[model samples]
Target: MDVIVIETPQLGDRSYLVHDGVVALVIDPQRDTDRVEAAALEAGVTITHVAETHLHNDYVTGGYDLAQAHGAEYLVNAADPVSFEREPVTDGQIVQIGAFRVTVVATPGHTHTHVSYIVSDGTTEAVFSGGSLLYGSVGRTDLVAAIDTVGLTHDQYASVRKLVHEAQHDAALFPTHGFGSFCSSGPATGAGSSTIGEQITTNHALTDADEEHFVATLIANLTAYPSYYAHMAPANMQGPGPADLEVPESLDAAELTRRLADGEWVVDLRNRVAFSSGHLQGAVSFEYGNGSNFTTYLGWVLPWDEKLTLVGTHADVEDAIRDLSRIGIDSPDAAIGTEPRALAPDAPVASYPRVGWAELARDHAAGDVLLDARRTDEFADGHLIGAVNVPLHEILSRMDEIPAGTIWVHCGSGYRAGVAASLLQRAGRDVVHVDASFADVESAGMPMAEKAV
Candidate 1:
């Protein structure tokens, strides 16, 4: 038997496949179908079962179309009393294929209908845990009406116990979401798989903490769900077809400028400090605590729902497009992939940073001005002693205050710094978007000023 996991970084989601001999089952597919279809063909198998762990809030699921093409049956936890065209898999139901016997466990803390599947292939095995369990944490219990406060908290506790208690000793665990996930608990893990004993032994959520403390800690650390979540839930619940897959090309610098000047808001997904120094004049930043942070936020932040002309330091654009497409905003023509075009003075001037951190420090000490592009709270905590603070989102109106020098800019981390560097470099400014740890020169060890108490 073979199990494949597809991680979609764009929308903070993942998909799973369980195969035995020529038969297979896929769970929580991404909007793009090509990735999964290609996986099946390469594995030398025929897909026959599509199972959704739950209604997703991050991106649309392509389970339906995949099931249709392969003449497979699609399954969801029908015990929730919800309606669906495919067969409803209930708690304790076992799905047998070749040497694999997948037993459905009703693990519903994240949602009323959510279930975790334990796949035993008669060997050291794994569980198709969906959102029920993950590395260092668990799923968020806040997805639409399916979430009942007391019920969910209680259910989540029970679910955690069931997964830990009822699971086979040797079964490894896999979840649909992980860190940076809008619906996942976090230590921001990037782990692909772990054993049930591993989670119980190491996962903070499954540790010695009592149920009450567990629930309390979960609620406190949880960030609010993204705006696009509402849309994604229905699309997945209805079993939307596979995403029309495509690898989008990113736009070159000049074309990116043209698109922005024409009204598209560049999203600087990079971390803080780096963003502080400089970025496209009007790019929307996700380095702060406004909840939604992934490229999926592009749907909520983009002006008038215009097609994007994306620019990022990473050469891979497929994840970005997949992230965008998950919330129902797919466009193969969205980006212009890197080939550097020229932008005029009137063009919108967002840029990605090309300078390294060490060089930034040297420029800063050489009398180059350092700027801090972070939220008011982060800037107020501690920044480079002489650096200026201008949050990325407010750059347009505050552009007037920017000093005319060889500016060395920074954000909390480096992503924003890169964007700022890109824009400034394109504008012919001798600006170094500093990706190092910089401060707005408050006292040491402070957070955003206003957010402090």
Candidate 2:
């Protein structure tokens, strides 16, 4: 038996394609199914079944459409009240695909109806633990509802223990969340691969036996997730089709200016340095590159279903569209170019200063405001002594709360601060992008404070 890992780095999730030479079982596929089809074709395997562990919260699912396209069985939890027809799977049920035997296990923590699959071909065994049992932590429990948090926390603790007890110690443990995903309740031990035995010895959910303590810590540590997540489960429940991955309608300088004048979202996908150097006056910065999580931040901050326009190089614009489509933001208008002046010839180009913490320390003044763009929990852990905390996600609604003057902004890293800085610059505030590591705060000799417990 061979298990293929399909990673979605933008959302920090994985989909699995498990096969036994001739047949494959797809699990938790994303909105885009072409990649899955390509993997199946390359492996020379027939897709016999497509299964979903639970209704996903981060992105749309393609399981329904994939199964329909291949004339395969679409498996979903029978307990879930979904809109479409499916081959409903229940706990302790065994499903056979070619030489593989899959046993479904009920592990309801990530959601009320979540399940995991243990596959064995009488010799090799693996567990596909989606959201229930993550690398270092379990999935966050509060996504279901605020009132059900405590109950789900207990369910998560038991679910991890149950999965470990049921699967063989040598069974390869593959989880769908916890690879830099917000779905993870806590930090995932940066392990590329893990086994049931390794997770038994290392994972917090299994190692810590005190249920109440685990519940408290998990609840206290939960932070805000993306605003875009609210629409995902509903869409998934209705059985979404494959994403539309076409290139956006091309816009010239005049059309780009018209969109900006109409107050449509025009995101600049350049690095923070280039963005701060010169950009179209109204465009917000959501840099697309090797390290930047352009999809996550842009999707989180933008209003859901709003008219979004992309301004960047043609390649970058195309990449950004693909990334956005995975998260269900599709068919945005685009203006592609290397320079802002070229993208919008007649529009005035705007500029801002990008600095480091050291410079802020040297130029420390009486009234110059320091803005922290991290989440409230991040701000509480430690922040500049006099900085205002307006997380990037809440920047639009909380604009009035930010004090006027030359505001210097920073985040844990500078990525989020770049987004916040762009928003501030667009709002006509005197802004400076503190584009440096937060680790330099101590070396820069800046005053810092921790929220009093």
Candidate 3:
């Protein structure tokens, strides 16, 4: 069997296309279906089946659309209450594609009806474990609901153990999450795929002492996932429509202003330094960089149905739209491809001053309000003394809680701090962007404290 791994680094997820030289099957595909389609063409095989391990909570699935387009059978868990027509699959059911045999194994943990598929070509075996058994970690169990966390954690443990011990112990394991994904319970010990035998020895969930201890550790380690996750389940249940890959038309300053008047989101896609130097008033900053979590933050903070106008270059706008589409954000209402200064020629521009670690320490000592924009767990691990732990995602909502003064915002790295500084400036607060490493905070002789329990 020929197994191709399609990686979505933006969301830190993977999809698989397994073929046996004549016919192929796709598992847990993202909304961008062209990649999978191209792979099938390159392999000289027809896509005969598209299967989903579960209704995804991190991004929209392309299984239904791809199946419909290719006239392939779409498979989903029989227990999931989806609105669209699908070939509902149950446990132990085997489907044949050319010389490959794909068997479904019920592994409910990440979601109530999650399953893993084992594909074999008689000689070698491969397991398409969507969110169950990851490389070195397991999927986080709390995305569904708070009440279901303990129950799901228990299921996750049993599911991983079953996959590693009972079913296909020698099969190669490929999971959708855990490479840098927030969906994982914790960071994976390493990258790339692992075999069931290897995971059985190294995976924490599979090697834990007991179910109770595993559940506790799993639940305690879950950080605040993106707010966008709340919309994914319902969207998946309703069956997301076909994605539109076309870029939107560019709007001028007057048109953008009118839209902004109607409460549309005007996102500035320039670097933090450019945004901090000067940007249109009220435009939120989300710098487009390699490591920037643009989709997560934008989707988390922006209204789902509101019109969005993005301000960036042609290349920047195209890249942003594509990245956003992975998470069900198909298109923006309009995109401004000109430079910010050109578009907003006469508009009032805002700016924020950047500060170094030494200056931040002096400001902190002088009673200036310091805000740590990292996650709460990071704050608990180690943070500057007297700094408020208002994570970047919660900054806009919790603006009232911030003291009325010059706020100095810093994240573990400087990306989020730049985002927070823009939001604070837009809110009419005097802000100083602490654009330095948080690791240097303590090394610079600044007082630090652990989170009080």
Candidate 4:
């Protein structure tokens, strides 16, 4: 009677490895199998089975590999129309892992093929809801159009009601994608695992609500999905697509251009305006989408061997790297902009320009206004004596706020300042970015002003 939840921070996707003495089961594994397998080996347990709640659009599923590696059964939802070497798990079928009983419940909504597994050590039933239900929200129903998503939402509403109202009281709920995922259609914070009843009472989307209302709510917030979905479907339907998912060894702009010409897909993780201005003639973008969340659609739409390169705005390569990785899309070398240090870190900072009170006074004395380009939260703190807050994410939205003149932008640790500089530069603004090195901050003896509120 042992259960473990492993969180992949890069993607905000959670995987579970449930074991009972001699028997073990791996659910919704992330990119790295070593960690899961290592845990099992360390615990002196054998991975008896591997299963996915559904065919994921986010990251590549590792169930087949785990099953192949361990000679265990690879289980998927029978409702999935795609063909695969899967043992169709029957609804309400109980799977054994030593003393633990894992029950299958076909809870389809996010996609037609998705399901949830209820694991109970005799008394407490914990549900592994792949994408059906999350902490304060429900799964997005728009991905799979095979079944009417509205109809599926209705069924999902009923399925959740059944689980919460009658099936298993105190059945702990575990979901794959949690907070900060595009697949999530409702509130996601303070979520790890919860009972069906807790979700029924507390899940805002499900509380005292009916099916029609649920469908409307889900539709309202859903943004224009990444275009990768066009490519991901066929890739998933084919068996064991590709295991060695890594970015290309070399992919400069020229190489990516060639790949696009050869009918391969290129997903630029840049914003809509930047993408619209100029991109690899055919490259589609989800720049606004978090790498992992949007990457699911990226992974689903592209082939394992397809030559793909990322064209993100300045200073998002690390995020781009991890996001694409979790969804099983390897990134290419030579990302946009110079490879800068991580967005923020605990030191004074790294080498670059320093703009302290002296320079601040000079700029302000010369009629220049300080531009604070961190995210809204970062700006909400304190800032320089006088600075205008313009977060990078919302800069494009508030282009009018930025007067047509030279503006200085700075962020904590100075990572986002470069991005703001690049974006503002693109928008034809005169921007001298304060790429402040940690040494510069210390040398200038500038007050450690909090970001603007």
- CA lDDT of every candidate: 0.65, 0.89, 0.84, 0.63
> By how many angstroms RMSD does model 1 differ from the true structure?
6.6
RMSD of 4: 9.6
Which lDDT value does model 1 have at 381?
Answer: 54
Candidate 4, 205: how far from true, in Å?
3.6
Q: Write the per-residue lDDT of candidate 2 for residues 56-168, one digit (tens) a residue.
A: 98888999999999999998999988999899999999999999999999999999999999999999799999999888888999898899999999999999898989999
Query: Which whole-number lDDT from 0 to 100 does residue 142 have in model 4?
Result: 79
Q: How does candidate 1 score on lDDT?
A: 0.65
- What local lDDT score does residue 396 receive in model 3, on the 0 to 100 scale? 79
State which candidate has the highest TM-score. Answer: 2
Question: Could you say which candidate leads in lDDT?
Answer: 2
Candidate that beats the other on TM-score, 2 or 4, i.e. the better one:
2
Q: Give the residue spans of candidate 2 off by over 4 A.
A: 450-453
All candidates' TM-scores? 0.72, 0.98, 0.96, 0.64
TM-score of 4: 0.64
The local lDDT score (0 to 100) that residue 421 gets in candidate 4 is 58
- The residue pairs that clash in candidate 2, if any, are none
Q: Write the per-residue lDDT of candidate 1 for residues 1-453, one digit (tens) a residue.
A: 788888776556778877886888888887676788788888988888888888776767777777787788888777644345787898899988667888888988778788988888777577877777877778877675644655686687778778778787667778888845767864647586678888887887777468788777776666545566767776665666556447555555566666566655555544444344444565544442223344644454333355655444443345565656667776634343222223234444444444545555434455566677676656655555566787654554466688887777767656555445544554456665555545332333323334334
Superposed Cα deviation of residue 300, candidate 4 (Å): 12
